[model samples]
Target: MRFDELDSKMRIYETAADYCVLPGMYMVARLDGRSFTRLTKDVCQFEAPFDTGFRDLMAETAENLMTCGFRVWYAYSESDEISLLFDRDEQLFGRKLRKYNSTLAAEASAKFSLLLGHVATFDCRISQLPSENLVVDYFRWRNEDAARNALNAYCYWTLRKTGLDEQQATSRTCGLSVSQKNQLLYEHGLNFNDVPAWQKRGIGLYWEEIEKNAQNPLTGESVMARRRRIKRNFDLPMKDQYDGFIQSFFTRSPSRGIS
Candidate 1:
């Protein structure tokens, strides 16, 4: 076969299942650490339940993803997962799902592994939300999930610290209610309410405009210039308040679809 013909034939096999997100749909890419339980607990031996170092690593990885070319409007990181909300008008790679899944996973893996000085990998998937309300609900779901996971982590670790084996600790917390979990931690002299808000609600990142004092190069006159930067929020609100936080990113007028 001719080289061009052969190339075209092989390319079809690679792209046969390619899918693109439709225009006007909100795209949220969620990247989860692969085998992170073993990686963090066994190999890296990070402090169980929560570690400030590990948390910072995840936050930094999310920040890298936000600035790595795509127009990410917001980022949320919790546990071993990072979620990025892309601008509605982002048309990169023709909005192909495979492009996002592959690029984001690779980007996160590379960035995190470099930061941690070990090999860590991440898997990514894109959520295509049809309406603004759904987007708000999606983040709310993750926000609430962070709270649940934080409670369980503290409870599980507390049991482990008090001589409970892995199986025993798991069994102890299995059917416990949220209040029960809080009580368990309270008995251990840890107040769930006193836990860092970032640990419970996760961290949020968004771009903000800030003014900088500068001097004009030619005139040497003082001037104020505005620039955009990624701002990290460790103190995220909860429930309805969080919904308002996510909705704030929708300030831009909605685009009907790709032109």
Candidate 2:
């Protein structure tokens, strides 16, 4: 057998099962911390329920993903998870799902470990959206989840601070409705609504264009150039208000996608 024939045969085996995302559909790569329960509470000993340090680490990791590769239009992070919305026409790795998933997980794991001063792992998955409406709904769903998680965390930590064991705290919050959880916080002199929006709604990162004036070394002439950079938004809105933000991003960029 010839060497070229053998090499071609081996390459087919590796790529035979590779799956690629639809070219015209929007791609969302969501990365979640693996076994974060043990990592946060047992290993790192983050503040009960929520900690600023851990939150900052997640935010920084999200920022790194935003700038890593692919033109991510929006990045959202909450709890131990981050979701990155890639451009509609992204062709990196030929839109290979395996490439996007493994690379993002690797990047997130590396960045998070460096930020936390300890080893951490993130597992990533890709979501394909057929239209813009699904994209809007997807983020709204995550935002609502952030709200629920925030309420439960505060309630659980308060119970723990008041001497309830882990099992008891879990039992106490189990089956509790949203209003019930808010009331539980209020009874303890904590206002759920007063909690920081970022904690409840998650953090968002996207690109923003700014004008930079540059002087040509040869001509010594001042000229304006448009520069694009990542911008983090911690004060994200909820419900219908957030929908507007999604719509704005979709329209803000010049015809980056088809109709």
Predicted structure with the largest TM-score when compared to the true one: 1
lDDT of 1 at 76: 98
Per-residue C-alpha lDDT of model 1 across residues 56-143, encoded as one tens digit per residue: 9999999999888998889999999999999888999999999999999999999999999999999999999998899999999999
Q: At residue 207, what lDDT does model 2 achieve?
A: 81
Off by over 4 Å in 1: 252-259
**TM, every model:** 0.96, 0.95
Best by lDDT: 1
User: Would you list the clashing residue pairs of candidate 2?
Assistant: none
Candidate models: Cα lDDT each: 0.92, 0.89
Model 1 global lDDT (CA atoms, 0 to 1): 0.92
Candidate 2 lDDT over residue span 116-188, tens digit each: 8899999999999999999999999999999988889999999999999989999999999989998999999
- CA shift of 222, model 1, Å: 1.8
Instruction: Give stretches of model 2 more than 4 Å off.
Output: 257-259
Scanning candidate 2 in windows of ten residues, the lowest lDDT window is 250-259
